[model samples]
Target: MVSETVSVSVPGNVDLAGDLEVPPSSRGVVLFAHGSGSSRHSPRNRAVAEALRRNGWGTLLMDLLTEDEERSDALSGQFRFDIELLGERTAIAVDWLAKHPSTSGLPVHVFGASTGAAAALVAAAERPDRVVSVVSRGGRPDLAGGAVGRVRVPVLLLVGGRDEHVLDLNRKAAEELPETHRVQVVPGASHLFEEPGALEQVAAAARDWFLQSAGSGPG
Candidate 1:
């Protein structure tokens, strides 16, 4: 396997910092969209990425915001909740991956956490010709608004059983999604999935989802 730090440029002069890992004979690549107030260095997301790499899948974990923007949002908490902006950034990253030589030609999937899941759904809607599948970990898919209904690709929504409100929201969002959607609740886990085996379950579920959905064709 090979791992490297990459810089991806999007529109509006924004440059995203990311960690890309490609395993030998990788079947596809999964782009990670972190939730509000998080970044590419999120430990939980990194763990999941490691699991995917072990499963022979490439992974890209990128920060959706620039340093200056993150600093500004740290005080006002404004951009963190801006799902449209986040979705646009995610779409740009998808395009970047499509054009990047090393990752191009590989089926693309998205793994989103929290609000990032909303952005992932929106990106899936926007790039139906690229994104093959999407998985949300403790995500707020309801925040995707009408974009949720437009996501034709298979989607897996993983929620913590202990997180009642979020689970309810996932259920509601599933109603608007295609029949290929699924909602899995990990028992004893909260929003963070900090329980002993909770995160492992999440990684396993995500790995299986991406593997199963790979080469199924575009969204």
Candidate 2:
């Protein structure tokens, strides 16, 4: 296993901090785009990353915003909903992953949470060749706007069963996506999947989808 802290440079002369981990004989790399107000250290994302690593995958958990931007967003709630900026930054991170020595040429998957899910979809649409698949957790894919229609890769939309509104949103987004898409509901869970075993279910489903996309899942 190889683990390191990395700095990813995006547009606008900003640097984002990330934690990268690659298992020996990695199958691929999954880039995590955390939701509004979340950071690279998101416990839920970290848990999922750990699961992916244990299964011979590389994971990159990056903060979509710089420290200064985070502080400002915290005060004024200005940047959290900037889906365009978030999407651009996420796409640029994919470029960074493509060029990085450790992750270069590796198939890339995107895991997005909350508003970050919209950004993830945008990134997938923008970098069709670089991103192999995408998984969104309790995400607002509707916020991705028209970019949702342009995504060519497989997409998995995971919503908590009880997160009714978001579930509906995912359904609507799925309608606009390409045929290779699924909207999966996690039963007995809420928006955050705070119930015991709920998050584990998410991690498992994500693992399956990513592996399947990489053609490494069960026959």
Candidate 3:
């Protein structure tokens, strides 16, 4: 496998920092969209990315915000909830992946966490031809608003059984998703899935979902 830090240039001359890792023979690439106030360096996301890599899938963990923007957001917490902007950036990253030498020909998948789930949906809606599937880990996909109904790809919404409110939200969001979508609850886990073995279950579920939905055509 090969891993490197990359800078993805988006609109407005913005560059998002990322860590891209591709296995010797990858089935596809999974782009990770972190949740509220998180970045590519998030430990949870890094753990998940490692799991995907072990399964022969490439992974890209990126910070959707610029360093300066992130600094500003740290105080106001404004940009984290800007779903529209986040989605736009995610879509732009998809375009960057298409041109990158390593991931150009691979099928693209999105793994979203928390609010990032909504951004993933919007990205899928915006670039149906590029994204093959989406997976939300304790995500607020409802935040994607109308974009939820527009995503044609198979989506897997993973929620913690103990997180009643978020689970309910996921159920509602699942209804608007394509027929191939589903909501899988990880019993005993909370929002963070910090309990022993909880994160492993999440990684397993995501790996299985990506493998199963890979053959499905574009969203």
Report lDDT per candidate: 0.93, 0.92, 0.92
Candidate 1 lDDT by residue in tens digits, 139-171: 999999999989989999999999999999999
Q: Give per-model TM-scores.
A: 0.98, 0.97, 0.97
Considering lDDT, where higher is better, how would the candidates rank from best to worst?
1, 3, 2
Task: State the lDDT of candidate 2 residue by residue for 121-184, as single tens digits.
Answer: 9999999878989999999999999999999888999999999999999999999997489999
**Candidate 3 residue pairs in backbone clash:** none
Model 2 bad stretches (over 4 Å): 216-219
Error of 3 at 113 (Å): 0.3
Off by over 4 Å in 3: none
lDDT-better candidate, 1 vs 2: 1
lDDT of 3 by residue, 96-155 (tens): 889898999999999999999999999999999999999999999999999998998989
The superposed Cα distance between candidate 3 and the true structure at residue 71, in angstroms, equals 1.9
RMSD of each: 0.9, 2.4, 0.9
Evaluated against the true structure, the overall lDDT of model 3 is 0.92
Summing lDDT over every window of 10 consecutive residues in candidate 2, give the lowest-scoring window. 210-219
Model 1, position 22, has a per-residue lDDT of: 87
